[model samples]
Target: MHRPAVIALHYQNDILHPDGLIRVGLSEDDQKRTQLLVAAKKMLDGARAHGWPIIHVRVAYRHDYADLIQNAPILKSVANIGAVKEGSWGSDFYQALAPREDCFNEHVVTHKRINPFYDTQLCVLLRGLNIERVLIAGVATHSVVESTARHAVDCGFHVTVAADACASASSESHNHSLNSMRLIAEVSDVQSTLEALK
Candidate 1:
């Protein structure tokens, strides 16, 4: 069995925080939000225990929004609300799942697009680490999570999405994305993935 790199996408405050802007599909219920956090942390802890590489991905734009593509409404809103502005509180990772400073092996990938690899060093970093497979999980399972999974596959890396550890704008959205991803990647729960890491 090959060791897989864990790619955690868009767990930043701007997306998952209760006060954060992009709130439509994020877990609104207290119980549901807590469960998502716990599941995400569990997978990260499991990766750390096994010495697997963990990559935390975030999306942020410049103050002037010059770096933003200005193509989609969501992208436009980011600029309007000044969301995920670099060095802003909204850009920071959520407290619970933020990467530890002492963890030398933990990596961070900052991107402007939904796909973490685009115009980012994610692919080079994975290649340099000799990574062949990736375990992906993140907020809005229908967006960044699914987009990155598809990109990872095209990059020739075997992709697996940790289904339970991910959330979407709605349950239907999450399920639909997973079903679409199933054609190109393996979609499984976090526990099973951790066991596979062993």
Candidate 2:
């Protein structure tokens, strides 16, 4: 059986583009992503019930665009990329998923390329805590969750993708990534993961 673990949930902001595209950016109070908010709460509730640690990773860039340009060159070249940058409505953590004042011992905020651990201290933090199993739930299943799952597995962590705690830009993208994850990691629902913790 796997040992006790911490959870990683990616909270991000969404933007309504003039061309009818919803851009993924930094999460803030105003963004209020309904699906991700529900997922975050579910993760927290599950973790609390089992006394597990929960770590939140938020993605944000710099307002000057220097950060993305320096770290994620491909995304920088893409036109009208959506990412939470400082001093913008898109940069704040969505209030709905915001941790209560005392839920976490520490937190991580970063501007990463796809994976939260990339160029970020997330891996080191998990290592320091001796975490070998991770329950992941977050926005854009094909993006953050998928990216992290790959790296987590490579790093030797038993990874579980909470399906109910995640969503994508479209249903197709969601299913596609889930299928991909099944080959790399375990894919489960909120209840199943909760049961495992129990």
Candidate 3:
């Protein structure tokens, strides 16, 4: 059986759909569709009930755009077009899927890159816990989730993507991304994955 901590990737509150413009903030419907807040909740709930650890990998800068400007020029340029900024609602996790103080066992990384493992302490933390399998969930199915999944596999971690627990700007992109992930990792919905874990 797989013993793993659920690694919920960055659920940042920026608009990452349509034209990749931050000005296109998530509306009520977009939040429901893109963030998949309820799906994430179910996954977390299952993990909590099973007494499994939860690692939240949030993306936030240190109140400055310098890191992104220096390390990720692509992100910096997008910010120039009104993308999310540090310490803003657009930069924080979505309200529904906010990190829980009591249940949040690890904040493995505060990332600038799309992949949470890149230049972050994620691998160190996991290795310290002797964790080898990672159950991935959270926002922007194509970007953050897929990016981290790819890197996690590269780092020799067994990765499982919670399909319904993730979302992207579009269904087409989300489906394609999930399909690609299935080729490289375990891809399933919350129920199927939780059942397998147990």
Candidate 4:
């Protein structure tokens, strides 16, 4: 069996917290659904129990925003709102989903772009840990989650996305992205994922 790892993406204050910088743009229902902290915690615990590495990924930019890419609408929104600056609380991992200090080989990977693999040490870390399959869970299903899933598939890792642990700005976008990811990755829920890890 391929060694598995859980890649929790973009579980940052700017995206998951109610008092987050971008929370105003999310619908009430979306905000409720975006509360993946509990589900992510469960997944992380399960992964640890199974001896799988847990990789927490977040997006953060320089305080000066010099490294940020504002070419796209989403990027522009992030820049305009001053979200996820390197030294700011908005860039910190969500409190409930933060990585545990006791877990061996657990990693906190930071990326400058939407895809966690882009110009990041994520691939290297996975390779060092001999990770061949990835279980992904995070916010904005249509963006970071989907982007990372597709990239993982392209990089030759078997990918599974925890459907219930991911949320978007709207239900429509979330479902749509999940359907799209289904074509390339296994789409599952947190319980099913935990069972598989065992």
Candidate 5:
């Protein structure tokens, strides 16, 4: 059996919280689409119950924004909004979806880019754990989730995405990303992923 780790990507307040800075720009319907805390909580519980390694991936930049690359439109918007600064509340993981201390050797990986694997120690950590497969759940399904899943496949790790545990700016974008990822990764809901892990 493949040893799988659960990588929860970018559950930061700036992205998922109701009062997040980015929320100021999102539509009400978009806000509704981001109601992922409950589903993420369930996924975490299942992963913990099965003793699967849980990795939390967050994106945060230096206080002076020196480490931030504003090449991308989304990143430029992030800088303009003053979101996700290191040590800021907006950069912290959403409380309910945070990894518990008792969770199976929980790991936290910070990245400055959308793809968690880029310029981060995520792959090294997974390799150290002998992880052969990864189950991903996170916010902005069309961005981080899709980017990371594609990179994971290139890195020779089997990927599974917990569909219900991921959210995006809107349902259409979310589903579109999921459909695209289906070509290279297994797409399953939280319950199905949990059951398979069990």
Candidate 6:
């Protein structure tokens, strides 16, 4: 009955798209990027088909970067490159993954930090939807993707990561993060996640 919601993170131009300023933070290889987007689309489409609540999450900051927290090299790099500026093209979701305005079952969340739940309506939204288990995937497997998944587990919901739908700067880092997540969260492929959603 699609009890678990699906959270899609950082499918924005600044992270996932080929022209993104931070695309290298995920992967610069055409094969890896294509594989990620294709797998993510499959997961999203499968979830949507089963009527699962879908949350599209992205990281964006004001033009002046007032809301950004420069606490790390990568965090500071966001401002240096002027990436993901709120309402700018780079901050917009990738064309194919953008949620339709008319989709009532989907929501969009924009955060200023690597973790989407901090100071965001994510938890509240999940509670309102009566969701207790979540399926998640995103860019930079060791960063926002890992952060959000860990928090979801701490929040007491059962967590499952769609491994194939996530990407990172390198294979080693991505696998390392997944291994770390396995300690607290379930790690599964997109097909497995889709089957569960069904």
TM-score of each model, in listed order: 0.95, 0.80, 0.84, 0.93, 0.93, 0.95
Per-residue lDDT of candidate 4, residues 48-122 (tens digit)? 888888899988999888999788898898888889999899999888888878877689999988888999899
TM-score for candidate 4: 0.93
Q: Enumerate residue pairs that collide in model 2.
A: 13-26, 13-27, 26-84, 27-92, 28-92
Worst 10 residues of 6 by lDDT: 24-33
> Model-by-model lDDT, in order?
0.87, 0.67, 0.74, 0.85, 0.86, 0.89
lDDT of 1 by residue, 80-108 (tens): 87789899888999988998888888999
Best by lDDT: 6
**Model 6 lDDT per residue over 76-188, tens place:** 99999999998898999998888877778999988887789999999999999999899999887999999999999999889999999998888999999999999998899
Q: Model 2, range 73-113, lDDT digits (tens) per residue?
A: 54653325555666556655555565556765545556446
lDDT of 3 by residue, 157-194 (tens): 99999998887656788899999999889999888988
TM-score quality measure for candidate 6:
0.95
Against the true structure, what is every candidate's RMSD? 1.3, 4.5, 3.4, 1.8, 2.0, 1.4
Which has the better TM-score: candidate 3, or candidate 5? 5
lDDT of 1: 0.87
Evaluate model 6: give its lDDT: 0.89
Candidate 5 regions with alpha-carbon error over 4 angstroms: 23-35
State the displacement of the C-alpha of residue 125, model 4, in Å, after optimal TM-score superposition. Answer: 1.2
Candidate number that wins on TM-score, 1 or 2: 1
Model 3: what TM-score? Answer: 0.84
Error of 5 at 157 (Å): 0.7
Rank the models by lDDT, top first: 6, 1, 5, 4, 3, 2
Clashing pairs in 3: none
